[model samples]
Target: MPAARESLLDAAYAALMRRPWSAVRMVDVAVSAGVSRQTLYNEFGSKDGLARALVRREADGYLAGVERALGSAAGPRDRLTATAEWTAGAARENVLVRAMLTGCWTERLPAPPLAPVPSCTAVPAQRRADGPLPTPRDFVRMVRDRAVTVLAGPGASPADTAELLRTCELVVRLALSCVAAPPGEGGMAELVRAVLPRHLV
Candidate 1:
């Protein structure tokens, strides 16, 4: 079922890339995945449900990239730079990610509710998908909190926690700004490094 679920999502994404979301048929997605329409419905419940799951998957992937960037072996500032780079890169590469970060859902994309939708499904993945989706502000806060957690690791002084959080927010917001209006030749990494202080927690 997990494999089928992924295959369906892949097909749905491919279809979405080719046409507007409103025109993307559930049957087409199921056929592209080589699965029955009933299987698709059983898995996602409805087209809107599928949209939520796909959007949720994109958000998860972007956050996973953020974690990887944050966990890099580089210095604290470098790691923050990496995280910022990841944020900008993810937004640029994936329209769904860009929409999630910028809160700009074009007519071609599905705009699922940021608030949680009621869930009656027994499927674990769909249930989680039906949970509250992160808004753009939530993404900023999420990235900031993750950066603070990674940098101020394990019994670090509480005194600098406030400063650290502020710095993290700056880094996250700067990255988002770059997504909207890309920086000049300096690129995201240099811009991130320049903006982040020499002392990163």
Candidate 2:
């Protein structure tokens, strides 16, 4: 089932790149995935559901990259710099990333309402029901929380932890700003260096 879902999403993403999201047809996605239309509907409920899943997957991948950047760098400053660079680079290169960063999906199709999943009496539930679907703001908060965790090293003093979290928040805001409106000169790394504490740099 997971493999089938991923195949459907892969098809949808490929279709998105070629045309606006609104133009993508469920039948086409089903055919592309080599699955029946009923299977697609069973998996995602609706186009919006599919989109939410795709966006969540992309966001997870981006966060993984941020984690890698944090681990790869030697110092706090370098880690923040690497993260900023990754964010900016991803936004510039990936259309989906840009849309997620800017919250501007005007070029894509409108997200339709999600249909409810039908109850299956025979099959057991694979996963527990989540409270609610996360909004874009929620995704941003998740990213910030992860950044704070990475920035605040193990055995950090309470005072130091607070300061580091503040720095992480600032860096996240700066990265998002760069995504929304990229700087004409100096680049994202320079922008990050300017806002970061000199001692860390």
Candidate 3:
């Protein structure tokens, strides 16, 4: 069900875009995914399971984008700028992403249980999803740590690395603000650059 699992997730997302999560039918999702309703159940035990898996994937996707931003060829400051910009952009475009970053789940979305549920499913992916989803604080730490790891590099003293961590946290926290009120024109890059230490390389 590897391929089918992905297809189901894709269909679930597409269905979500068309209507609220409450209105998204499992049978419809299965039809759109080209898999049987039973297959959808096998992949995700229930709609709540599907929501958890979807939220988990969205969180992973957000972090994946953060990695891409950090991996850019630009210098340290510019790279941080890119990370901030991506954070803001992702939240703006994806309601699920916005909910993940802000912890503001509206009635239209599925606010799945954040804690681990008793899942009997044998699917590893679903098991992982059954576990706690990242909180907004968790997302902040994750993005900050990734930025620090990529930018700090080897040979740096522990003290400098600590300062870098603070800078990364600052950028991430500021970027999260965009979920409510986005920055103008320059997106978050300008603000990130302004806060970043001039000596960052």
Q: Each candidate's TM vs. the true structure?
A: 0.95, 0.79, 0.95
Q: Summarize candidate 2's per-residue lDDT along 1-201 as a digit string, tens digits.
A: 378888987899898888898899999999999999998888766676677666656666677888888788788778887887787778777776666665666657444222233433221221111113344465566666777687776897898767766777777778878876887665766877787666667
Give the lowest summed-lDDT range of ten residues in model 3. Answer: 186-195
List, residue by residue over 38-119, the lDDT tens digit for candidate 1.
9999999999999999999999999999999999856887788888888988999899999999999999999999889999
Please give the ranking of all candidate structures by lDDT, highest first, separated by commas. Answer: 1, 3, 2
lDDT of each: 0.91, 0.70, 0.90
* Top candidate (lDDT): 1
What is the number of backbone collisions in each predicted candidate, taken in the order shown? 0, 1, 0
- Could you tell me which 10 consecutive residues in candidate 2 have the lowest summed lDDT? 122-131
| Better structure of 1 and 3 per lDDT | 1
Clashing pairs in 3: none
Model 2 spans with C-alpha error above 4 angstroms: 110-136, 183-186
All candidates: CA RMSD in angstroms?
Answer: 1.5, 3.8, 1.4
Report the CA-based lDDT of candidate 2 relative to the real structure.
0.70
Task: Pull out the clashing pairs in model 1.
Answer: none
Local lDDT at 126 for model 1: 98
